[model samples]
Target chain A: MTREQEAAVINAVLDGDVNAYEYLVKAYEKNVYNLALRMVGNSEDAYDMSQEAFIKAYNSLHSFRGDSKFSVWLYRIVSNVCLDYLRARNRKATVSLSVENDDGEDVELDIADEASSPQALLDRSLTRDAVRRGLQALPPDHREILLLREIQGLSYEEIADTLDLEVGTVKSRIFRARKKLCAFLIKDGNIPDYVSSSKLRGGDLS
Target chain B: MNMCEYYQELISRMLDDELNNQERKVLAEHLSVCEECAAVYSAFSMLSDTVANDLVEPPEELAEDIMAHIRRAEMRKRNQREQRAKRAASRQIRNIVAAAACVAVLVAAVGGVSVVRNLRRSNAVYESRKIESSSGTTAQGGLVDATVLAPTPVPTAAPAPSSAPVSQYTAPAAESNDNGGLGSIIRSWWGGDDGWFSSPAPTPVPTYSVPQITPPGYGSTVTPEPYAPQVAQSEAAPIVVIPDTPVVTETPVVTEAPVVAETPVVTETPVVTETPVVTETPVVTETPVVTETPVVTETPVVTEAPVVTETPVVTENPVVTETPVVTETPVVTETPVVTETPVVTETPVVTETPVEPQLSMAQPDTFSDAFIPENSFAPEGMAGTPGMDMSFSALPDFEEAPADFAAVSAVSYDFSEQDCTEFVNAIFGLEEETADDAQSVQTDAAAAEANSGAEQYLSYIDKLIATEQLVPVTLPEELLPDRTESLTFSHEGFKFSLDIRFYGEQMCVLGCDGQGQQLCFMSDMSAEEYDTFVKDCLLLNEVE
Candidate 1:
């Protein structure tokens, strides 16, 4: 948070304006959702876990210490609550995104209306399919850190803050998790020899 | 760092932009050379890309559900808080009242306890003191101890020294009398039967011709005593045994004795002098115990003693000033403790004494509206229950009374036993009781009419018949002198009429003369029912 915004929040919380907590909730909701979806390997669970984490944060906010940012504290609570829920339900059975790669099978369209743009819907549908297949192949833990970094757009420090870990640990986990996902996508042939020679600090990103 | 670990971390940091340019360059160069780190880094990147693009949105209602749940929680908490506040308000008052009641009980109990303790202590002290004083007066020390109960409980504790040394052991009654035959009886009765320490086996209460005040409920009036005297009550430190009721009357008093209480009703004879003191020396006759206590009669005192034990300090009697209140304590009047033997002595006497059952009211020669039985001689309490000599009191006001003393006497005459049983049967939905009493009334009427011609029918009684309806009647004083009128009714299509005429005298209520009336049942209702059906309905409405 900005210095001014952080102070305002702290003041509001101290003044007992609990509803002001929504500011913090909305800010961290995406990152928390990404982490939860990856850990639980499901969309429905991810959404529920994210909402529950924020609610819990709101309730036990008084127990929070300023040693860490609010996002990190929230991340810790969400990860633990979702992990426990998945563990209790035996997380092994939980599936990741359903983006399956079609080797030879014809895909059906969910959009049946004539007014619907068939090509646009098809593109979106194919994207989901490819992503799902790639995600499901990667283990939940790896898939989670990557998503937090990629989509939720959390920085190394922010990710560490959310996952309740050191910046070094976050870096290591993300690296290992990415390595696994890359291997799966390659085996599925989703990427066709794709080292496009992106800009590197001193050498090619390839 | 080894090339492998170095590449792993470098690739990881590069994925997050955490490394500096130099490190990123090294990681890129390492990844190009190392197949393992490159594979790991790419997999991580792809996974992150897919999950974020595809998965999270919840169904819509959950947010609303949470808000509703919160509102409900707040409402419940508010209700609970309000309830707590209400209870707290009432609790303060209840606690104060309960506390006051508790304290009052405690004080009264303490007062009573201290009083009894003082009395006992005083008795021992008085006896010992008397022994000290009379050491030279009487030569026989053995008789001295038994003979006297000297120093009374003076409010201060100093009198314990003056107490005489009487034998702590109870002495025989003969020893208590000390050669004076009636002295011990007077003392025993004076103390009113409590803590007779050295006085042994109470002087077999000699049957003094004491008037027995029937305490509230001993059936009848016991005999009044003659030649009883009020002895020197305040001074003589006397003890007395108060036998149960026929011996002493219980005055109604509040029962405020403590929980653990042995309330010995000390109905003492207080002196009329300036010092209204309760003396141990007194007459054992039936005198109204405790005086005209402005509060209540004496029983209230006895009852209050019990209440005192429950409350330690009280608002009603705070600073129990030992106010020399000769006034009786508020005693709860014991319910009519009806003694059987008293009933034997009393009821027979009243019955045999030839009570002037004569209401003695002279009938107006030409009775006016004022002479209506309901206004004047409506039988009060003798309900139509057979042979029960019902003493009439709580009777409802009646409009008219039947004529003749026999009719009045028959107020106790219950011929409706059959109909009553039938009503009872219908209530239980069963068959009725036998018509035996009803038959008797019918036969009794027939026999009475045959014995005397209608002109001379002064001893006849009205026979109530159920033709369509059954009406309970009350007879006036003048009408009780003769059978005046007969009314008809119908019930459930059954009909009956009463044929009535005067009988005799003094056998009925309010008079020595019983004006008897003859009764005959005319059994028929169909015609009677048809004739006045609407009027009957109107009467039904007016019956109440």
Candidate 2:
């Protein structure tokens, strides 16, 4: 829904036409459900988490300040509900993707160059299952931000607002998150680490 | 990796379409040369595409389930509201009933005169009625008089000293009858009669015997101790503890002698004294002559001796001579001393005259030194119109004049005659100007005080808002802030107004209706609850 339509529906629900909330639920359910699905890795729990998030949003609908898009605000609540569920289940992220060096800078992974063009390799090898496995394998923080950015198509600024992070932090974290997913994909043997053939040397460019 | 790190961050921004032209061009140029960064960019792009395509359909019943939960919640809330309204209605009914009961009692107390009379008869009856009527009246009119009268009649009737034991024996029997009468009166008033008028007529008969019988029984037994002391001392002691046994055993011997002997012994002494004194004193000449001789001789001798001796020897010569001599000597001596003191005082007056002349000699020198510069400078400036010459010559003296004037005023009031007149005129002019200036200053000060007072009040209101003691609200246009009234705000889609009243030190915000009566469902909430309610209203306004 457009922001104006979303605001109208929210106002109607708050104005005692409680059934007007169904318009919001229908508009954002697919993205919210998919975000929860990607976080929890199961459909039943995903459905339950989505419902809880919607109810919580409805209960606190008066607190919405309209500082951001309604979807961004809703996604924040969705992510918080799923995070609480993950925390309650004691499912700590298995892989720590963003490593800090002695200087407290994120240590990037060094991928070995292979002899194939990257676009052709990505087209042939980057399957949906591989991406899902890589996403599921990611730490919950990185997974959440990436899902907000990719699955929900939120901008970095919108992600920053939703997650209450600085825009610079959002950019760096998304980069680190993408690198970690790529490393995961490589480790899972789903794709080759191929560089484009026109390079003098791709590794020397950094 | 170090060089690629910055470009890689740009590449991530590029994927998100966040990079500006400069960074985009730089990242594009680097990616054209850098195979590793290019491969990473391609991987990120494919991952973004894949994740964006991976939308899952939610369960069909999800929205229905949410709506179901919400509906149930709304139903529960509606039920709670209904229950609260019912509770409020019942509370209002209870208040009305209580008010009606109060009115009934007031009507009965004021109009029921016979009820008051019936209540006065029994002592116990008076006490019970006092308890019932205590809330309505002072319980005083006939009831207090009856209680005072109840104990008196029995003691007065049986004044014969011998009846102490008899009255003590009858007192308890009379007490039981009083109790029975009181109980029946109370039962008639409370149970049978409708509590107002009908019970008064029958109640008086039974209650009448109580005051009469009980008081006399107690009175003759208790009061005769002081009246008939002989019987009381012997018999009343034992009667108090074991009243029946002691009174029965002791009554026969003690009762007859006290009654018979007590009367004549009381009357015989006065008769004996009166008859003997009258008959013998007039008939016996020897006794009269003997008594008269000593009285006559002693009166004259004692009276004449002291008067003649004391008057001549002590009073006349000593008082007259000593007072005259002593008073005259002091007067004569004090006259000389008073005369000599003026001579001594004249010497100091003569000495002070010289000091006055000397001070006069020194006064003119200081006045000339101080006033000459001012006198010289004022005329020279007026006399010389040339700017350079006046500024050069008179400025230093002009500065010195004010210094000299301040110093001289501090030091003395002495001034030359002409300067003094000019000085007085200048002071008069300054005083008038200062008076006008002071009035204007006071006006400004008053305005400033008012502004400061308003600021203090506003600051206090701000502090109250900060501490949540008072909730700042935007009153609707029709409502005045100074009046005790309510403002309507919507919460959860229901429009309601809370009456804002200040109760002494506290601000009480209660849910009220159109008539301004507090809703029974929202009565007497605590301070914290009021804060919560006000915050909820503010939040609802913000949401709207």
Candidate 3:
């Protein structure tokens, strides 16, 4: 739905029909859950955190005031929920944030699964594991920033709003996050030499 | 190292597409010189690319799970509100009984001393009781007041009614008190609506539970008229102020989150300093680059070739130079009077002045004497007798050669002011009964022919120039015409020549080919026919 439609739905929710809020939750649930899962590093905790964020957003719907996009506001709530959970538990750095299949087993999430036969899965599992380990190796703040920049593909302004930081801070932090992740991958020999060599000159950094 | 640090920030901004063009240019130039920065940027870029390709999708049931939680929370809130309302009702009933007992005791204690006075004033107490019952009618007014004053109490259950008459009488006051306290806390939290609860209730306080009704159409268009009667009832009493605390204290958790969260936020240092340094240099440089190119192109055109001055006619027709010299060279060399003329005197650049008569006088004494035939047979169009001294100075009158003749032209000559009317009419058997009639006929024919024929000739010239088949050959010094009107054109292996001149009163036409072969068509039926045939040689540049 467009922002105007979201605003109309929010107004209906505030006027006491609380069911109208399900539209907003349904619209942003995937992005919010993905953001939470990346931040908290586990399916169970990510699920709990996403629920809490949506509940909190619904209760506070009256205070929204329509100053920014609904997605930006919703992402802010998701980020805060994840941050609070992370801060409360003081979670260890070496936690893997991955998706789980219907059977509650941790599985790699591949959008194009036609080639995911056993042989292809076996070949890709190595690289996927290396990348996940490299992500887990960074500080939580750096990992979160990198996830927002690369995985979410958010603009600097949206990232700033979600993290409650200046746009410049978001830029510099994204840079620092990438550089640190690169160092981690390099130290583990996860990345090939061509990545750090002249062959990578045409790549996009931001 | 400091420069590297600054450029690192700039490079980061560049990757974000945050850098303006000038800053981007400066950073690019810096990167070219600094291999260390270049390597760092590349590594960052590679890392970003690798991470972007590895995306982690959320579980499919996440949205359903979130929605389930929200619906469960809404249900729990509603159940809690209903339970709270039940509890409030029971508590209100007990409080009402206790208040009635106290009122009875107070009346009994003062009963005897004021009995005689009370009996006299019993009518007044009954009247006041009637007013107290009016306050009881204000239940709906109280709820509207609470809703308008403090909206945070929206989902909570409404206050229950008291059973005793006195407690019911004070119920509206108690509701307003609840709103005042809750409104105060909300005011403190939002820093708005402070005066709403600050003033005491000037209107009569409604002392009963207000009815809760959703407006028609699922409460889509809620009008304020439902509370209109409540406002009227509240105006009956003015001194009731009940201090309620439960809802006011509970509101802080809902409204104060932002207040608690805003203070500890890390202050953002000035990060926008680099933008001004990006500057207008990019725009400034861009404008000058566009403007300088045209100036550069025009300088070469003016300084290089003045002979090719006029763009199309003079430059494309360089052949005019070699060909027109045929007439001008001889004119300058043969006549002492005309020798003073400029070399570029063709066309209108040299005045056609009264030099015509002087040039004509000079021409007959010299060149014309060779071309005139003595005792020439009378031409078919001539009215004069045959052999009558047909030389330039001694030609006979030919009756104005009536204007009914066709115009003719030959190769290598500018056919200026010459109408070979009588010659063309006599040769073509055009009977001229009257000058006006014949002239009109001839004029119409010439116009039609010139339109089609001139267009064909212009296109033929265009084809010759395009193919580069027409070479310009200079006339031999002795062969140049004395009059600049004569022109020569050459093609293949042949040069064709035409000279249109006046000898005394007679007009003469001369044609020559490259082999020194000459034909002079002065006046005869055959000569007129030959003149027509020779013009074809001008187009093909061939003599057969």
Candidate 4:
């Protein structure tokens, strides 16, 4: 929904037209549910979290300042509910994808040369399954920001606003999260590394 | 790897379209040179696309479930509001009824005052008239005696000629002669006969004189002359002669003597008794009227007492009922204030004041460690150790104490029974008489504690007991002697040690929970109890 239309619907809900809330719910439910799924890594917990987020958003609808996009605000609630759920269950990240190299700088993941082109990778269902598995393996904080930026299609500033972080932190966290996902995919052998020797020589020259 | 790391972060930002043109140009230059950066860029871009397309549809019933819950919550809120309004309305009605009862009592009191005032006025009037009638009777008797003595000389002068008949006649004549002698003499003198001087004329003449004169005198005389003659005739034959003469003289006197004798009879008896009788009869009749009025007034006055008594009784009943109801509400409301502010405020001050020394002495690891050397204290400490253990085990059972106390209080207004049974059972486990005595002490202590602002703490302790948060531990009687003391076992595995000491008239029970929160319970103490408790504490200190 557009910003003005979303605000109008919110006002109607606040004015006691409870049915007006269904419009906002219907518009955002898919994105909210997918974000919750990526964060929680299970359909059942994701569904419950999404419903809780919507209810919390409706209950505190009057506190919405309209300064941010309605979806960004809704995603913030979804993110919080998911984080609280993960924290309550004490779910630790299973795989640590980002590792400090010998030079004390974060190294970008080396994707295979065969998966170099976006169009070629897009055609493969195996790459999509590998990406989903990789997203689930990332820590909750990194996964949350990545979901907001990529799946929810929020801008870096909007992701920062949703997760209550600085834009710089959002950029770095997203980069780290992407590097982790790529490393997981490469380790899983989803991408064939046909040109790794040539890339390593080029990296040493740089 | 370092140069590639910088460009890759730009690549991550660029996938989100967050790069400025200059940074994008730098990132594009680096990506063209670095093959690893290009692959990373392509993979990051492809991953973003795949995640963006990954959508999970929510269950269709989610909105319906949420709305159903909201609707139920709204309904619950509305019901609570309605119940609150109903309670407020009922409270208003009770207030109006109490106000109306007060007005009714005021009206009854005013009415009773007026009735009493009317009775006093009527009583005053009756008393004044009685005094006047009594004095009037004595004055009339004096006049009758004067008239009787005045005629005696005339009879004595004629005594020689009729001495034989005079002896017989004088006895009968003497009585009536006392009343009629003056009337007959004056009448005879006026009629030219000297009948009163001729006392020996016959006993019949004196008797006849009495009836004739006495009728006119009936009103003035204290004694009713007509009633006197009837009484005398029944008693004596000489009085019979008076009736015979009246019959004999009736025909003759009706024509001539009535004119001659009645004028003299009227003139003489009125002169002698008519004035007095006229005054006396009306006075008598007035006194009767007054007496009759008093009788009438007295009956209503007697009725007024019951009316006054009954109204006061009715007034007193409502007042009595209203006082407790009004008093109890204040006590209930004040209890919270007492508990929250005053009790909390005073507890520390009382503990710090006189009990500072005892607190320092008792601050050892265990009470028994500090107190074991004293002769009287060892048994109590040893006894109390097992008692404390029993108290912990028995703590759960005393949870029903508060509910029982509430039920008992609801059934009876007499606090002694409920307080004694609950407190004794819950805390002391003392005998019934000891419980009774302890309850009385507690009542006095409660009243004194209320004055000193420690009542709130006691009542708060009471509330805690009621809620089963605080468990009452019975202490040995020798520990505080004449003072009631109990240790409250802590909740949630908090270790607490209790210290009892007196500060002024207040008995302070101080303890610290495992979390370091200070819990102080205060009760009032009489001066004598304070002295005794102080002496015992000092004895223990000296022995130590």
Candidate 5:
């Protein structure tokens, strides 16, 4: 939809036609869900984070300001919600390991099925899994940069706006992040160390 | 690995296609010569491919779930608002009853005080008359005549001695009438003549019962204590924290500007305006040095009058004065530091220039797929199929046998393994006009050779056989003495432009430069190989 149409829907929602918000939800749901999934690293948590972000966006609809694209603004809300969840989870992870599950409180990552059979692990695409693990291993700041570039396909300027950073910082940061991920992939054996040396001998490039 | 480290970053940027033509040229040469760096490049490409290929499908119910959650939240909000309204209504009713009871109590208290005061006045009059009548009939007759003699009203005359305090009432009328013996006796008794009359008006003793004056916002009617030295009147200035209704009792005071003025709020305005201006002046003055000097001086000149008006003004001026001086010196000292902020800002612009091409290169919609061009090469619509080409240990060969020409063999050279000193010197020495001249020469020879027609077929064969060695495209006029290495060839009518370089043991064409409208070829790619690579791998439209 055009920006004007989306803005009109937003206006309708704000004008007490609360159901008009459904159009906005429908328009961005897929991308928002994908962003949340990448950020939090799990389907269930991603769903929760997506819902939380939408609810937050709805609650603070008056503050949306409309200066930026709705998608960029919405993604920022999703990113923040995921960051909050991650922070809470990290905080919980640092605490005692007592069985606090019954309280339905925030808990450390369950690590559900992260470990697989050796065959399954081998069969898994080394690049895909390694890159995923590499992304997870990076600091949140760097990881977000990679996701916005590689996954979301945001330009340096767009990422800068989303992250509230200078564009130059974004470029150098992305370069650094890609380097780190390459290092991680190499260290984790997703990429073989001797690949370049082996290819040093003459062979057909075609 | 150490040799590969430098090229590692370049390889990552290459996979992202963030490199400009110049950097790409450097990397291409490095990769051809150094297999180790080429392998790193391949790994980086594979990592990009993985991220691009793994597309996660969002849950279908996502929109529905969001809408349901919003609806639930809205319902919950509506209920909470209704409850709040009900609570507010009940609380408001309670407040009304409480206020009504307070008014009733206040009225009763005022009425009781008025009744007591009236009773005391009547008693004082009766006692005075009895005392006068008992003294002498002649004196009483004189008092009656004197009452007629007074110009004041009869009621005022009766209550004069009865209600008013003796000290306050003794002034005008008592002095003028002092010639009358009765009046003189009264004055003498009031003014230290203790023998004649011992306390004439006992009712005036209830001075403590008079209501005290209290300012608004204070809780009680009692007069407040004097202002403390450290506590300025402005600090005691009342803030109207009340939201909906104004406090009726304090309405007259809070509404009056004079009341605020009395509390030094007027003085505070100049101080408040001056403080921010003084603190801001140094910063403003440093930036616009010419105009601001006068402004700073003028502010002090304007403040000088108010400063002389009161000691408070005097104290405030020094604060503003000292603040500007202290802040100004640091700001001046920080001018160099402030100057450094722009330098830091300029660094970003320098850095930003590099990103501009990356932006123009990585155009918006296609960039997501740009890094994963490998996905487009997926055999027979096998796009997004994970683990399809995870192996980067060896270069993959396409064997559908479609091309009539034999595979263009890889010319192994490490463009990455350049000596730092030699590489820097070579790059600096290669001017664009000189390179362009060489490229023109190279293209013309290839075009002439291909235009010769018989030699065209031979050149294609020459390109394949020439892969075994580092064949430098000889410049018609030696562009570089020892460093120049590249292959130029033509197939059909098109001439291939190449810049081949040999760094130590690594020998390969470094990069392709389309100096004019002409397209160039990588060192290892013959005409047919270039065609297949373009078709199968590179998106022609994406060539930035």
Candidate 6:
């Protein structure tokens, strides 16, 4: 949990106890995979990118600057790799960069209708896949804003810098993106009308 | 504004985990009632979950490859530097060995040549003298001596000419310039190579920087000015040629180098002397500057320190929390501790949630010296509670004390509203011993038509009250300490003094009454208490 403990584990993995890398893999695997999947919009590429992000992370371990926390640094690398892969693979496909430069503290919604209570984590396996499908179907601008704000976890300021825009512009686009997401979620019957704003912003931080 | 915009700023900030105290209170209170705002909060949070659901895992083989690249790079650079170092090291060793061998060869050649030259000179001198003696020739022998010595001096003069000018070559110049016998003897005395002429020499008459009053005649002897009179001989290196002047006359040139070498040593001796001098002078000077600096610093430190500290102490004690923001900057740094919270709480300024504890978690303001009352009722309570009717009760009641606690202060039988009430008229209506007993008690009916007046009876009571010091008259100023507190009273054709202690709500008064009756009374209850006896039981209201 501490930075020292994580660094020690990283060092152990680097020393060639190849399987020891799994502790790190298990710790950060899902978040990295989710970020990649969100950025690229396809599972196969997402899976490959996630795997590659880990391999690149392991190989460039010495270059780890430690200016950011280990999770943020790894997430940044993973996010960047996803963006680059998406950019390289699809030259013809238009991908408007949203607030993609934000820091890794983005908020993600599970569509409140999925849970009986807002605080409850979604337990259904296929539900996540459905949401992923829904996310991929949306435009890149909408998807990237959602990913940066929620998945990649970037702040508006950081996203503005990465995408080259003003913070107000980033905020507006995220607003439009969330509005579109809200429309889609409401159309899909994901959240009921009774659901309130407090439950949305007050998701169980504890 | 729409509910969204109404709570828009707070909703955004709260999502960021940034609510300061007052903002949190406002928001929390709002959240308690507004269902629509709560719904918006719920929806915003759901988007948070959907956005972060998929995490991309990295490939496992990355770390080893990067390390391999770095290690190879380091090794390559190290090998390149090491190879270059090895070549330079070998070249340097070879050059040192060759230089050492050349030095040895030169020493051998110089020694051998010098020995051969000395032998030839000795042999030539012997042969010339022998030939001159055999032929009895003197001028030719002198000519031979000059030729041999003149040519021989050339090699020695060319190489060591600078030092040679002192003795080796000085003899000839000194001899030729001898215009008088004294000059010739003086030249001889200073001429010929000796220890004084070894190495190069310091200038023969070394001039240095001094308070040069060119000894009046020396100014007329301006010929010495050609060499810049009194220019320190140290300015010229002793190993160089001295000017070819009569005063320095090349004979003493070699002495310059030895003198130059000793100059630094001689100057250093005086430095050692001045170190002792400096230590002595410093002690003499140190007391004034050292003591002066501290004394100057101390008075201000001692005087201003407390003043500065006192401001901080007062401000710290005052809790000028809000007022400080207004007057904060003007107040000198004495108690700037008041505003230190500004920097620390800036984070709360943004989110404003953590700021809630300040409102709910603050200490009782009663302890703060700066807290002023906001209510009329709270003459005692601080900040003023809302519901209490403090205005009517806020100020302490300063009503007159009772003449007698047991006796009713209301309407006495001064005039009859009716001759008698049904209860009073009926003899057996009241619960007493009987009407005859009451009549027996008022039996002083005709005793000399009540010998004295009612005023006389009242005067007796006044005397009794006055003796007790409860007559409400001011006590002698001498008997009371300055600022001592006492009750103020006026009563029943008689002034009343009651030193009542405030026990929370009830004012308890302990004093002697009109009959000099000592009693203690504690009451806040209304008049009905005396009748129902819920409270206000008097210990003494006696009559005979």
TM-score of A-chain in each prediction? Answer: 0.65, 0.78, 0.74, 0.79, 0.76, 0.58
Question: DockQ (Cα-based) per candidate?
Answer: 0.21, 0.30, 0.21, 0.30, 0.25, 0.15
Please give the distance, in angstroms, between residue B43's alpha carbon in candidate 2 and its true position after superposition. 0.5
Candidates sorted by lDDT, best first? 4, 2, 5, 3, 1, 6
Listed for each candidate, the true contacts retained, as a fraction, are 0.32, 0.69, 0.48, 0.52, 0.63, 0.38
lDDT of 6 by residue, A110-171 (tens): 22232333344345433354455456545566566556667656676666654556877766
- For model 1, residues B287-318, the per-residue Cα lDDT tens digits are 11222221111111111111122112111122
Candidate 4 wrongly placed segments (more than 4 Å): A92-125, A192-206, B96-544
Give per-residue CA lDDT, model 4, range B38-86, as digits (tens): 8777777778888888776777876676676666665787789898998
Better of 1 and 3 by lDDT: 3
Cα displacement (angstroms), candidate 2, residue B315, comes to 99
What would the per-residue lDDT of candidate 6 be over residues B1-544, giving only the tens digit for each residue? 3555446446545654445788777877777787756665565566666556445344454334334444565467669889888878877888886785576557635644543432232122111100000000012110000000000000101111111111110011101011100001101000011100000011111111000111111000001111222112211211111111111211121111111112221111111111111111222113322111111111111111111222222122122111112112122121122112111111111121111111110111100101111110010000100000000010011011111110111001111111111112121123344334323322442242422222222233333334442222221111111110012121111112222222223333323322322233333432332223211111111110
Docking class of 6: incorrect
Which stretches of candidate 1 lie above 4 Å from their native place? A1-18, A90-128, A151-167, A196-206, B1-9, B27-63, B70-97, B110-544
lDDT: worst 10-residue window of model 2 chain B: B379-388
Top candidate when judged by lDDT against the true structure: 4
B64-141, model 5: which lDDT tens digit per residue?
A: 888888888889999999999999998998898788657655764564454344223212211110001000001111
Output DockQ, candidate 2.
Answer: 0.30
Cα deviation of A125, candidate 4, in Å:
4.6
> Weakest 10 consecutive residues, lDDT, candidate 4 chain B?
B128-137
Kindly report the root-mean-square deviation of model 1 from the true structure over all alpha carbons. Answer: 26.8
After superposing all C-alphas onto the true structure, candidate 6 shows an RMSD in angstroms of 55.3
Interface RMSD of 1: 6.0
